[model samples]
Target: MRYIHTIKPLGNRRLLAGSCMLILLPLFFLCFTQTARAGKDPNILFNGCQVLFQGEKPYIDQNNCTQVPADFAADYLGAVISQDTSQKTISITKGDTGIILWTEEKKALVNGREVSPDSGAVNRNGTVMVPLRLVCETLGSGVEWVAETKTIRVTLDNGYILPESTCLSIIAPPPGNPDKIGLSILLFLDRDLDKQYDDIHFIMTGIFDTIQADEIVKHIGQKKTPKDNLPYRKWVRDDRAVTAGSEPGDSSISIIIWETGG
Candidate 1:
């Protein structure tokens, strides 16, 4: 036995908290569809924590750059933000990675690597607004914009994704599932739930449409764990069992997750 216990995620995988197992097909990971907000002011969630701005709320420009105050950006990124008032530059530093932006330029120097994303830092009124999506992703955090309520949800590497209730707010919540933290994003696209659970094994069923599955994963910024193994594919995070699976030649995604306790 070579003990092939792990299959690398095609990209950054945002598996929620706890250990889970999946018996899955060979998934093809494609360019993840980016979330966008239309013409609406967006509320922000940072690592499951709601961000409170002093006076200005988050604004998505026509260029689709989610801009926030420099101070708030510093707080959200846990970085030190400094300004060059004379030269009109803002330097945001986290660990060894440094990013420098200017109020008049869309170009930025990320650790001496010059790059630009959509738009750049802007001085609106007396406050310097920073391009949040660019900065957050630069710092290695996953960003998802919920167009329904015009919300920005962030998943930091040091933090888990949105909590159960918040996640349910983004996805369809079932009528009667025992609110498991990880299961909040599991299960199906849309269905009524009448589940029975007493001990070890738990099961539920959903009409699995591959496109819908991809859409669900995209909506929440999660990629399905892929493996060459046809029927048995496993992608679990930490240390508890919660999984989804389906049978061969079947169009159903069955939910099968368990834990030690009842």
Candidate 2:
């Protein structure tokens, strides 16, 4: 996969350490409405995750810019949207930031400053669709298009995205090892956990919502191997403490180990 990292001074972006294994299990539960095909169809991703559109799916307009339903920003980014039918204008507000756009206009007012969107706002099928990049940028988020997958990853403050690590390696014992059986997967990222909090909490949000650090520890502790005829212990064990801290640095790697017997 071709991945690009874009960083800007977005008011001190902070990194937090956590496991995203929860994201893998819940993929079965999500409902995919459709896929992005050519320019007629488009899929919207929120915070590097696919969004489940309720009504009209997103589409690319004549301007070659992706447009989404008016309420999409409100639902995903917590932005409040309001429209004036008589004036053909729309307004959005999040925290101290305010954005104003006109129906079929190419310029938007960001916090009282006029800015041109990659594409103007247009009303389609009674739904006001605006440029995807415009909405995200106005809301303090970054949008990246992955042409290989036809997917867009919109991250807040350029936060970490899925396939979390750029480099991954797995090591396992050869099959039929009489003395021991073990496996280890190392996931590495290009950045470090900001400040390295001592009591760092692991909150996995994505496929699943934010999970508490304590819950993860308990889940690992309760894991039991299935009963079988094999002489090895039922459960696998690893040296990792459910709660661990990162070293002081900009790069980080997490090694997760699973073992059956020794």
Candidate 3:
């Protein structure tokens, strides 16, 4: 950013300098526009891990809506995205939900239904910037905009977004329906709250890198794998049974705990 100017012949050089400054003025404005267009890069945490954006980073627009890279956001949201440069169109689909939008257009298609919003995806220096909320909400994903920190947190339905080094557990029949026992409810638990349960049957989820199965094993006293090679490992402590596992392809882990004795 440091500039060096060499002194030359006094009279004609002064006039030449003025002419050069005029030419560089437009170039300076272009640089400023590029930087300001993206606004600021608020940290985006997808599934408890900060997403590293390549080329153009995610930023907040003037309207306070988040704009993100098309491919990156599609992958994180578990949606398949197809782009047509010639048409300036983007199509994102997850399960039965479908979303289609064009660059620089506020009109978007959700499940073949047309709706116009404030602003849609736009092309930024060859990178297609899509509105994070518009697409995520249509696909049934969680989008949290933290105004204080200016950060965005996203969670997809396929997996749970968990806190670092901690698991969020929730007992089955969740509070009101305590009488509905022995019910197997698969929950993608993402929060922690005080709950009362006379009989324990809880499901938990957390990040693997920040917290592993070993951390939960201690709370359940000791674990033992049956010599007969049972389908699942045994975890025992204070008449309680706990089992924790993670998918080989996923970064999150799931734990199920239940009371072994009444």
Candidate 4:
């Protein structure tokens, strides 16, 4: 036997419309949330291509500036970063350039002088995030911001090149390791020698710019056997090293000499 049943119709159209609205509202909200997140892409480009960070990826802060991990500048940009939680400050050193930033402060200390930047350093997720453009530029890198694609193009300015007979020297604390933490100078002779240069006596003088490396040497040369000058010792001797080089392997006979600096 076959049975036929009559379909029941809604008496109140408003109730049926209300039920539909409840279901559709949630779906609309989900779509809107997903689209908002998809539109926000923070990408950092080295030169013109994307460079991946080992652990943390750089993000765009509220100021719409790229903020990268502290280690990224240290490892890739050859910058030395130090943090003092008590002071809420972050210090970065590269070559003869040094900058100190306070969290949420718009001003930065460029080589001990205060200057305001577009964006300041911020603390996020226990990691200090620095303004990418200001820090990278201070580290001798050129940065271009593409607003249409939300990209930060960083072209690391090939470091200063030394004269043919000159040596690229670095004097500071050891980086990437902590066991050795005294004063040391690594001198890279621009020209190769059959053997190491022995008894290389040189006086130390500090300069504000890497381009002044040769000038500093000339200035010190004029000094007739100047007293042991360690101008940077008064500053924090932490894992901060000064360097001046465009690229590695361009020089021969790289010698690292350790000094007790007693």
Question: Candidate 3 on 143-190: residue-level lDDT in tens?
Answer: 675556666666544333333311222212211222322112111222
Q: Whole-model Cα lDDT per candidate?
A: 0.47, 0.46, 0.48, 0.45
User: Candidate 1: where are CA atoms >4 Å away?
Assistant: 1-39, 159-262
Candidate 4's C-alpha runs over 4 A off are: 1-39, 159-262
Name the regions of candidate 2 deviating beyond 4 angstroms.
Answer: 1-38, 158-201, 204-212, 215-262
RMSD of 2: 18.1
Instruction: Give the candidate number with the greatest TM-score.
Output: 3
- 1-262 per-residue lDDT for model 2 (tens digits): 3222221111221112222111112221122223444366654555333565655667776566777776666645545677777988777665556667788877776666666565667787777776677776656565676676777666554222223222222223322234332323222343222211111222222112234443433333232222211121122224212222223341333333333333
**For model 4, how does the per-residue alpha-carbon lDDT over 48-125 read when each residue is reduced to its tens digit?**
335555444566554555667666566446556677779998887754567778998776777765666666887866
What is the Cα-based lDDT of residue 74 in candidate 3?
42
Q: Candidate 1 lDDT, tens digit per residue, 1-262?
A: 1111111111221211211222212111111124554344677775444665665556776676777777654444445667778999888765555677889677777777666556778887777788876676665556776666666776654223233222121221211224432232232223212211100111111222344334333322222222211243333323434344544443324333333133
TM-score of each: 0.48, 0.50, 0.50, 0.45
Supply candidate 3's per-residue lDDT for 14: 9
Error of 1 at 58 (Å): 1.5
Question: Candidate 3's error at 21, in angstroms?
Answer: 58
**lDDT of candidate model 4 versus the reference:** 0.45
Q: Which candidate would rank higher by lDDT, 1 or 4?
A: 1
Task: Supply candidate 1's per-residue lDDT for 215.
Answer: 36
1 or 2, which is superior by lDDT? 1
Clashes per model (N, Cα, C within 3 A): 5, 1, 0, 1
Off by over 4 Å in 3: 1-38, 158-262
